[model samples]
Target: MPQTEIQILNHLPVELLSARTEDLCDILGGPTVINLGGKRPRPLVASSLLHGNEHAGFYAVQRFLQMNIGELPRSLIWFIGNVEAAKASRRRLEHQPDYNRIWTEGPRPENKMAMKLKQFIKEQRPFAAIDIHNNTGKNPHFVNVNVLEKKFLFLAHLFSEHIVYFTEPKEIFANAISEICPSVTLECGIVGDESGVDHAYQYLNAIMHLPEIYSLTETDDIHFYESVARMMVPPDTEILWEDQAPTNPNYIQLSRQIEEDNFKDVAKGSPIATFGGDGRILVMNQKSKELTDDYLSYSGNQIQLSTDSVPSMLTSDLRVIRQDCLGYLMVRRRLEI
Candidate 1:
């Protein structure tokens, strides 16, 4: 069984510097909650490794602590999630629930950890929250927010001008935290990228020292997009990446170049995939209803975009695509603020 409780620490654990992520659970014997109090009253909360395979956040945090052992600028609460999965270098085991997805109210054993974390947040009432993750595909680093408030947008702009606001896939950690304070989910590119680790470390460090984020203004160009739909492979259908063909006649064959399309505006009628036996594309809105017409159209055996739109998080990693989603369809939004 996955560890459902977290170990709390008032100071940085010096052993973390030499500890491998896999050994974290063995060290703490569970998830860990570290509070580094500083001059600032309301702490900045950062939750990392919700997906075990994404290690950039873990490394970034380690680097930050190593460099600034005794001189933190503000109160900080850090949650290290899914150390068991990190031991195996997998996103999550077959029996484990996605750590980020279990934040909603529930009594299930899997929900116990998230509930405990939520209770902690409620007691602390943090100034802001950040949940760091890494994509499985080739994509630029971006920030995702659950709300479009100025603080949220500004926080995201600090990392990248590419800001995505997603309301679906509810129960995400950032979404739950955003209800109380400004929160952003940072997608720090792929794992093992030194640049990603540096980017997150710098951003987190900057935010930790900030006296107030609500008064901040964006000096750089910022583009806002809303996630409109989630693309998923149909159940029981085989998936073939790139030029690979499927033996099953009803399988869907997505282009190997799918990841290449991330953040680019795909033109209408652009081919996204080819399916056997005249199967239609399966795209669903946040409501889980078939919204294929909103994003894609069927052309003979090929599925193409029905309208011009940008897609993010598209991945060639078949396992990730199956476990999470193919990607999300996005549309640019002009905010009055």
Candidate 2:
């Protein structure tokens, strides 16, 4: 289908931000952009709810707006995404593509909306960009950047000490907007957490008043990690393993608990899962190149990592496991300072 016209609002609707995220579809219809004037000239692009299930970004934006009812510290290009999906409280509707993945040129309505947004943002030439989200599992609030520049590092460190850098999965909001200015993605932990909402609001507020985003200093204490590989599980419908499918020869039982060990340093050959069926986990790197044979090993009935590494975002939610990814394998990188 051809792309249709998108909605862009110049002013806030009465009590729009106050509405629950799940109720947004009734007001905004679909993906919408709300551009508001601020004391500063260059706008700060804030995108949230790209995944419908995440609520931190929506509430944080609301809180920020509530505190500064009359005016904002800086110009804001607020992008509210996945409203239809939000109504259903899922990452995305079954028919719709992931909002974050359609920023590149494409034929989908979401893709066209993204292109329209990109053009508008380019015209504004914003100071910086922020795309906020919540983790489906238990994890620390961290920042993610696609680029390795000092300015990006400085911007990310302002939000949290833990930072992740990934280069693959192109056309995501932060990576795409980084072409115009510095951009960062915030993974504020857990949906509906008050602290998570506050953390995001504080970070957004701080950036609103930033005098300048120059470079990271040696004094900045930030723990940075680079994702080496992503662990992908089979679609839930395709293969039901272990817990769901015992007789089906398609899955092995994961040995370790999913949530607790996130970001824990594990030695090479640490047991990951026990053999059960003929299924194999897909392991891909930052380049989107598969490295299953290169990074995984099996000892007896156990599947193990080929090298010592840290993992993050290991989710126990079966729905997320099927929709997104199991988690990522990472290695810590020292700051050049």
Candidate 3:
């Protein structure tokens, strides 16, 4: 099991922001939780670096603390996670569990740490919770929530006009915290983009001073989607990149610019991928049941959409695609806000 011991501190070490990730680990130790207290009774919680390669959250939080300097408008609890992977500049080591996935319930050390965090939430009763992340694909900044409550949408819209609600891949930090307080996951573009860092920092600053998170009176302008299914490459299948077709029959040749389709509405019969031989693509809902022709189907060798939908988190990175999934399929949700 990976090291799950958490460190709790009451003060912010400003210099650590300027230091390298590995250096930050050396200074702060591991998975440190800090409480920057203010006059407010309940704190706002921000978590970052669940995936080590995604650095926007870390940098944004760092910059936010730097700008505030002294007392904040409200108390805040910051959870800095996956310092080991951050130090190595990868997502997570092969042996380690995904930090975000272990938050629900389990026996693993990471899950234990997650339970501890939940305890803290129960005790402190935070006003809101934010988990900052950076996507590996070309997509707009969006917020993800597990529940469609007014306060959740309000908090999500405060970060971005695009919002996604999903219940799959359970045990994520956002889902767990949403039960206690209005919580949302902010996807701030990709790693190392200064623009993403700036956007997240600004959003955090704005939320810090808010008296309360309430449902919006008018939300017609907001784009809401419900993630219903995940698209995946078969475990035994090999993915072929570039324009060249694969010699192996089990390979799937995805579009070279597959990730570019992210966040765009797909019309019915749009091609998503093509196979080398008789190999088929896999589409499964949150329950892990294979979707039939209602969602997607194969025409000759090409995989095409059978319904109008939107996909998110499509990535060209082969490793990420293989380890996680191709992306997620979403449908427009009409809600009264």
Model 3, residue 206: distance off in Å is 0.2
Model 1: worst 10 consecutive residues (lDDT sum) = 214-223
Q: Candidate 1, residues 1-337: lDDT per residue as tens digits?
A: 2487667888877888777787887777778888888777789998888988888888888887787777677788989998988888888878888888898888776577787777888789798899999987888999898887888877778889888888887889999888888899999998888789999999988988888786337544777788899898876778886478678777788877788899998888999988887444578987789888777877788888988889888888888777778888899887546
In model 1, where do residues sit more than 4 Å from their true spots? 216-220
Q: lDDT scores for all predictions?
A: 0.83, 0.82, 0.85
> Sorted on lDDT, highest at the top, how do the candidates line up?
3, 1, 2
Name the candidate, 2 or 3, with the larger TM-score value. 3
Clashes of 1: 1
Error of 1 at 150 (Å): 1.1
lDDT of 2 by residue, 1-337 (tens): 1223567899998667579998888888877888999999799899989999898888888888988888788889998888888998888888888888888998887788889889999999799999999886778899999998889888999999888988878879999999999999999998887889999999989999886687887534777888889888754223343455455566666633667768788888887666655666778886768888777887786779888878899887767777777788888888775
Colliding pairs, model 2: none
Q: Give the TM-score of each candidate.
A: 0.93, 0.92, 0.95
lDDT value, candidate 2, whole model: 0.82
- Estimate, for each residue in 228-277, the C-alpha lDDT of model 3 and write its tens digit: 88888887787887586677778788888988888899999998988766
